[model samples]
Target: MALPTVPHLSQDGIAFSAVKNRPAYAIASVDSALLLASLLQQEGAMRVTDVAARLGVSVSTAHRLLGMLVYRDFAEQLPDRRYAAGPVLRRGPVQQASVARLREVALPHLRGLVEAVGETANVMVLAGPDVRFVATVESDQVLRVGDRTGRTLPAHLSSGGKAVLATLDDERLAAVVASLDAAVAVRLERELRTVRRRGVAVNDQETEAGLTAVGVAVPPSGGVTGAALSVAAPSARYSRDRLPVWKEALAEAAGGIARDLGDG
Candidate 1:
């Protein structure tokens, strides 16, 4: 008997035909597993019950689907006992290697910055309109800013984001900030000019209360901006007089990474 064709949604949310000629490969269990994986990827960490609720399935079914995902390395149980997207699901094949290279080239420079500034140093890249912390080296101090590796934050609100934003051409910058309100857009346009003038960006407890940071954009020798390097500390410890020192350390680290990546 011929199976009836059914509409399916692709990863890009486009509707497509399924089940007809492909009925042999369209097992319900496999389809459910793929949907579960996609949900986990889109929603970040999710509990079994949460997944079940979202998928309109029984908890047992959600558990089984998650098990399959874990077995295939598409998802993992976080320390909090929730499931989050795993390595294979997060990056494309080429992006995985590119990110590895970025971390390798930035680690030494990040450590050096931490040692020089006595603050947490991070290597961040702009992922679309967001700033993502890819690697971090913490200062030895017991009360320093916490590690932010694998975290994403708004680009306009972070020093690293501002530093990277300063490197964009006017047209690109406008497009990236298009979602901002009129007041914020106007303010950010002015701030970018200042970042260009000072060659650094400062987040003075703007992103989070009681934290401050200094950032510098990594400029490749090829004349293109690559990433941003930043050093962060407690607001109490990050006094105005200390900005220059942190700025110098971050700039040096950024320059070193850029050079290593052939962007110096």
Candidate 2:
């Protein structure tokens, strides 16, 4: 049977006809496996049944293929029994190096920020349209925000993400907005303009109902593009009057990280 094909389009929206035809000697099983991997990587979590339906294969065959992908470290079964792209499939050495270096150099600054603001502080990097928390330092206060390491949130909704978004050039910013809903894209663009003017971004119960955060972009340096520093606190503890203090502390921490990256 011929493999199912989707039309490939260039940046200018021109279709590429050459890629539509399956090769003469294409192996069905190999093609199915590769296609399944692509689905997992692009669509995020999927159940076994969803995989079977998407691949036009039997449930047993889908299970076996997913098993092989798991064995090869290309996919992992989530706690909810859904499959997602695994470590191997998510690896990007250059991006990883930047994330790692940024996390390392920002730790001390994060700690300092936490001390100054008495709130949780985090370092995050933009991964596509999402922001991934790389490191976090929690405040000692009992009612403070918790560490957010390894958490991923929509870049447009996150304080750190919006701060980073404000730093992006027009073309890059447009690409990111294009991936979002029209209304959301318009709202985000307006917010980014404010972030740019103030040099700080605020997340007022956006990501979480009772949490508030303020962030500043860590200026790009040493091959790192979109990285930010944020301090989070409980909404009860947040107020407009505190913005100046929080913004100052976050800017100081972000600047320290940028300076450290420059020296390294």
Instruction: Give the Cα-based TM-score of candidate 2 against the true structure.
Output: 0.68
Evaluate residue 20 in candidate 1 and report its C-alpha lDDT on the 0 to 100 scale.
Answer: 18
What TM-score, computed on C-alpha atoms, does each candidate reach? 0.66, 0.68
> What residue runs in model 1 are displaced by over 4 Å at the alpha carbon?
1-94, 221-225
RMSD of each: 16.0, 15.7
| Candidate models: Cα lDDT each | 0.73, 0.79
Best by lDDT: 2
lDDT score for candidate 1 against the true structure: 0.73
Error of 1 at 97 (Å): 3.0
Q: Candidate 2, residues 1-264: lDDT per residue as tens digits?
A: 221331222233322121133355768898788777655654467899998987789999999999999999999999999998888877532265676688779999998998898888999888888887777887876555655665568889999999999999999888789999999999999999999999899998787666788988998888777889988887788999999999999888888888899999
How well is each residue in 92-178 modelled by candidate 1, as lDDT tens digits? 211333454677788999989988988788887777787766777877764566556556677887898999899998788888889
Summing lDDT over every window of 10 consecutive residues in candidate 2, give the lowest-scoring window.
10-19
Candidate 1 TM-score to native: 0.66
The whole-model C-alpha lDDT of candidate 2 against the native structure comes to 0.79
